[model samples]
Target: MAEGLFRFAAADLDDVEVSSAGIAAYGGDRVSPETLQILNERGVGLEGFRSRMVDEGIIQQATHIFCMTRSHLETLEALYPQACEKLYLVCEFAEIDGEVGRDVPDPIGGGRGAYEQVAACLDQAIAGIIGFLRGTGKGQAG
Candidate 1:
């Protein structure tokens, strides 16, 4: 969801490259039907989008790496200490409903409502992310 939203939101920017990978995902797995529905409702399509696991190549190429939870951050940091400087929680740039430092809950298997809530959270966070990137003059790549 974050990947699709970021790609749609940052579509106008040529310098930014948006991609999503999971810390525990099998390559070529399809996104959940709920995810497809939510994105489709927002006019964002995830056609040909298959899941991929995070690897050294992805880490080395990213200018900024946003994780959904602190656990994810810890995992990535432990595995790729050299990229620690670029690691960040996706919601770090914005607060959801006046709350700060909250993990963007994983909606997997939680049904449609859960997915909807996550999409809303990602919508706000993605906007803040764009603002942050532009403000820092680091929108060249991500």
Candidate 2:
């Protein structure tokens, strides 16, 4: 969801590489139907996405790593301490007031309404992400 949202938000920008991975994912698994449906409704394509577990190479290549939950960040930190400096929770970077960077709740196995709520949260966080990227001069704000 973050990858799609970031891509949609950064469509007009250049030289930005946005990707997503899981800390403990089953490789080759397709995205959840609920998520696919929600993204389709929002016009974010997910036609060929496959699940991938995070690896050392991915960690080394990423300039900024946004985790959906604090537990993910903790796991990555414990497994790849070298990449800790660049890791962050998406909500934390978004500076969600009074929220203490809560995990973007996973709506897996839930209905469309749950997916909708997750999408709304991702939309808000993605806006802040774009702003942060632009403020850092990594890409232009469009």
Candidate 3:
């Protein structure tokens, strides 16, 4: 979800700062071949891409933060209450019911179809987020 969402969300929010991180993402793992192929076909750049972990500074510095699931939102809150108000579950803004949807399901070890499914969901979520940010008059992505 991070991989695919970054592609669309980054472009949508090109006006706003955009970046993705894992709670414990591996550092510099070459993006999976299937992922690269999928995003590339969509014309999203895969160059200069590398994975990294979500750290305190990231949560601290972000004006608004988005996570893939409720667990992630909870984790972020547990670690930093000061940043909680700014955090959101990517699906939340879209009214997708993430707690019951569980997760977007990591498509990493899967095949092309799995990645595509993940990408689609992320694209919708990103659209919702972009709209939400715009509505709040928090017009700047911070």
Candidate 4:
């Protein structure tokens, strides 16, 4: 959901590359139907998208790595300490419901309402992410 939303929100920017990998994911698993429906409702379709496990190559290539939860960030930090400087919570740049630094609630298996809530959260966070990228001059080619 974050991947599709970020790609959609950042479509006008050519230098940014958006992708998603899970810390505990099995490669080749398809996105959930609920996820597809939510994104499709927003006019963002992630055709041919499949789950992947985070890898060293992905870590090395990423300029900024945003995690949905602190647990995910901690795991990434333990596995790739060298990339600590690039890691962040997805909501680091935004405040949700009058608070900052909140973990994006994972909506997996929680039904359509859960998915919709997550999509709305990602929508706000992704906008803040775009703003951060542009303001920091990180979204453009050097």
Q: Among these predicted structures, which one has the highest lDDT? A: 1
lDDT, candidate 1, equals 0.88
How does candidate 4 fare on TM-score? 0.95
Q: Which stretches of candidate 1 lie over 4 Å from their true place?
A: 139-142
Stretches off by above 4 angstroms in model 2 are: 95-100, 139-142
Comparing 1 with 2 on TM-score, the higher-scoring candidate is: 1
- Candidate 3 per-residue lDDT, tens place, 1-142, comes to 3545554565655446676777767978667887788778887776677888888777766787877777887888898888888887776666444442345667867778888888777777777777776666443232
In the predicted model 3, the residue pairs found to clash are none
Model 1 clash pairs are none
TM-scores for all candidates: the values are: 0.94, 0.90, 0.82, 0.95
- What C-alpha lDDT, on a 0 to 100 scale, does residue 56 get in candidate 2? 85
Q: State the lDDT at 35 in candidate 3.
A: 75
lDDT of each: 0.88, 0.79, 0.69, 0.87
Better of 1 and 4 by lDDT: 1
Q: Rank the candidates by TM-score, best first.
A: 4, 1, 2, 3
Of 1 and 3, the candidate ahead on TM-score is: 1
Ten contiguous residues with the weakest lDDT in model 4: 133-142
